[model samples]
Target: MTQHETPERGARLGRACGADGSGTAVGGAVVLLPGRPGMPLLSPGPVRALVRELARAGGPDGLATHVVQHADGCPERAVDEVVRRYGDVPVCLAGYGSGGLTALRGGGHPAVNSVLALAPCLPDEKASAPPEPVKHLAGRQVLIVHGTNDGRADPESSFRLAARAKKANRSTCRFEVHSDGHRLREHRSEVVALAVDFVLGSVMGGRWSRPVTDALAAPPPLGLRMPLASGFGRSLRG
Candidate 1:
């Protein structure tokens, strides 16, 4: 456990289960935006596991974790709150499903070092289609991690996000396709490991883009031997 610093101004504070109570400021400050409204910040179990895993792997000293719980369609509101609190020091948006939509939209902030959107939900009704927020993430360091077998947001969404990001002058955008579902329960540990490595590398080393041969290379999850199709989805929303 470490100590907490009450910034001189702008602080949106809230707590949930598994919040990494060490109170110590690890590698810079990180603002973790959970799922949108109606969806809890820490989704009960597996997602919490994912978070804990990231916090553990993030660094040797451990990083600070803050969760933003806002309503649906109010990601902008949460983004403002995050700006108020963290104030441009490498904000990490960790959202799932539509929450990922919220995270990407929040990227306009200058302090945002990178984004980790998992199974990001596109505004499109079609599962295979990309979301509307894909266009808003230009010039930002974004890592779209999706599951090949995802049923909710579809596996191709990551591809769409990556393609749009790449086209938008952000060549460093990364996409990690895994072999799991919307929740990524099968590769929970690997997900966090990637998240930690990416965040640390981005903040300290300014490295966010993952090396990829082809945008749609089929690979296993992070570490597991699960046969899966991994690649950036096609951008359908423009």
Candidate 2:
């Protein structure tokens, strides 16, 4: 794990080198925004797995990965800080749950080339004011993966976001895991592969081929029910 020069807010940053044993500063960077009340910069479940998969893929030469933790749950500010720290390198934004929402919000930053959001927790239009992120996401290449059976954050929210992005003419994609829940541990491998492909393709100028696109759009088998595993629950308290 590597540490960055401390930011003004004293937020801790963690880094992992590329899998090819390439030096840390060469390839594109992926900045992971943590979920609510973010304590651990890197979570232990699917998020961790995704990071590992990306590292193994060895993005361009440098391919450094980073996670920024925010105690106040201010993911927007965290993203800005990461952008400042990384300078001119291409950066892909990603997050889960509340962090996913933040990633969507931060995707509009000029420094962020792409975004990967998993089960993003979007604000309810009826409950409160519309989210600020929705306004800034136009023209971004965004991919959202949500579980149809997600209880903590409704899958409808993702559907709604997709509709809005389409209306705004953003390059966006959405995938639904039929029987999966919020954490989506059962589809962990698929999620990691999809995220890596989307991010790498965006940063490396690779095409989003038909096979990958089809796999992402394909729905889960009918009545498929994968048993919930430990550490797969969405902790409301964060």
Candidate 3:
């Protein structure tokens, strides 16, 4: 794994990536939230690869990235720190497992233009409590990528969340990695490529592909159950 320098200020750092140093015109930043509140910067294989790949794909521009080692026990709160760190740039909040739910919760932040959830693991409602909030996502884009064969988090639950999110924000869309597991090991390349596309488009601003656009307009489960093929980086984008 490669090493990164820590900025002098803002949020406890983990892998401050790309043009984090002065004089680099950072157009946007993608903050990665791990499944847990904190972990060693690059210990987790998936998180490591994500930060590396996204940064590499983004090149040395406005696509700087950082990992939140400790979310103050709240991913939503972590976003506020991210905004302070990135300054004047659109932010894409992405998370894994339960952290994905955290990213969804944090999407309401004004600086966040988009939210991405990978194998989100949401907790069961208390039955007395209200459902997850979707209203706050009104203008922001949201994408949920779940593995159909995920053993940890129920894929259906994410679909339900996506449906509500889609209703609140017509820009919401989802993709299912057929037969993949929680780690999404089987299609890591495709998943990372697709994620890079989504985050970059959301941060730098770009049009969605026809399939994504169609899903955005499709009803209920149709949009929430869109398939993510092995070559989706190219095929789905078309």
Output the number of the lDDT-best candidate: 3
Candidate 2 lDDT over residue span 130-212, tens digit each: 54446566656777888888888888777777666645644667767777788877777766666777776766556554434
lDDT of 3 at 44: 50
lDDT of 1 by residue, 144-215 (tens): 777777787765655655665555534234444455778777766556555555666655454332342222
lDDT of 3 by residue, 1-238 (tens): 1113334565454446766745466677787887775566554536777788777767465577878854544555556655555556788888888778888888888888999889998877577978888888889878889999999899988888888787778888898999999988888777776777788778877656666667677887888898876676765332
For candidate 2, give the lDDT.
0.63
Each candidate: RMSD: 8.1, 7.7, 4.4
Distance from true position, residue 189, model 1, in Å?
1.5
Best by TM-score: 3
lDDT of 3 at 57: 62
| Ten-residue stretch with the least lDDT total in model 2 | 221-230
Q: What is the lDDT of residue 101 in candidate 1?
A: 73
TM-score of 3: 0.86
Candidate 3: worst 10 consecutive residues by lDDT?
1-10
For model 2, state the Cα shift of residue 129 in Å.
3.2
